[model samples]
Target: MTGRENRRGRSRCREPQQSNHDVCVVPEEVSAHEGKPLYVLVALWCLKRGGWVNRGQIADAFGISERSATFQLTYLSRKKEQICCELRKVKRAGVPVESYEVRVTEVSPEAGVRKVSEKQREAVKTIQRGRVGNADGDVRELTRNIWNSLQRGRKA
Candidate 1:
């Protein structure tokens, strides 16, 4: 298949390298499609939310169906070469469904091109879960300490 067709069908691309100044200069081969700018923008939007986003969200925002939203997300996550994002089913209310997140490793090559990775995909999920859990744990501990202090004051 042609390169663009290959990307559309969800193929991988070469990993990009960081420049001396630490900016990522993604090679041109990353995103093969010319119409992926909107996809990348939406992906970034989802990533910034730092949580699960369903197909419905994309459809409502972009005026498309769940399937088309999925297709676009899949194409960007799987097919586009340079940008790396993660999509997985996180259990919510006992239903298995798709949600997405991304790590901003670089500026997109263009508005119509997005580059992402399979390796970092798993990392994205783990990192987000870990961050949230850690924050929750901290809050719980702080609350317990405060309660303990209040009890001591009452005794005094």
Candidate 2:
């Protein structure tokens, strides 16, 4: 099946990565689809809030159906280990069915992406905005440089 068709029916993504104010850039071979950008944005928004976000909230925010929201959230939960997020069902008074919530976890170290502090996040954004290197350069080196600088500051 073609990539678009595959994505319209699929409910998962490759090793998911999250950044600020930009689209995800997974390898094309394992890429999920164009909608991944939405998912990443929503997930990051939820992360910044420092609280669980429900399916209804995500649906309303993205203007998608609850089912579709669930799919997007499920895709993220599937990569929870990589993304440091988890899904939980919360009970509401007088509601027969429980709704889902996404919560960021503290286990980001073992995950694919390291836990980024607010200061570090801002620093990375500043460095990225001032970037002058090859656009296609590996971001790992950039992350490493930032990390080294942060470590040195801590040591001094």
Q: Which stretches of candidate 2 lie over 4 Å from their true place?
A: 1-36, 105-156
Best by TM-score: 2
* Candidate 1 residue lDDT tens string, 31-77: 33423444565565565555666667666554456666767667556
Task: Show the colliding residue pairs in model 1.
Answer: 30-81, 37-111, 37-112, 82-115, 82-116, 83-115, 83-116, 84-116, 84-117
Candidate 2: global Cα-lDDT? 0.60
Residue pairs in clash, model 2 = none
Give the least accurate 10-residue stretch of model 2, judged by summed lDDT.
20-29
lDDT tens digits by residue: candidate 2, 1-156: 123222334332323234323222232322333343555655665666678888777765544667777887886787755567878888899999888888855433243334679999898777756567664556868877899999999999
Clashes of each: 9, 0
Best by lDDT: 2
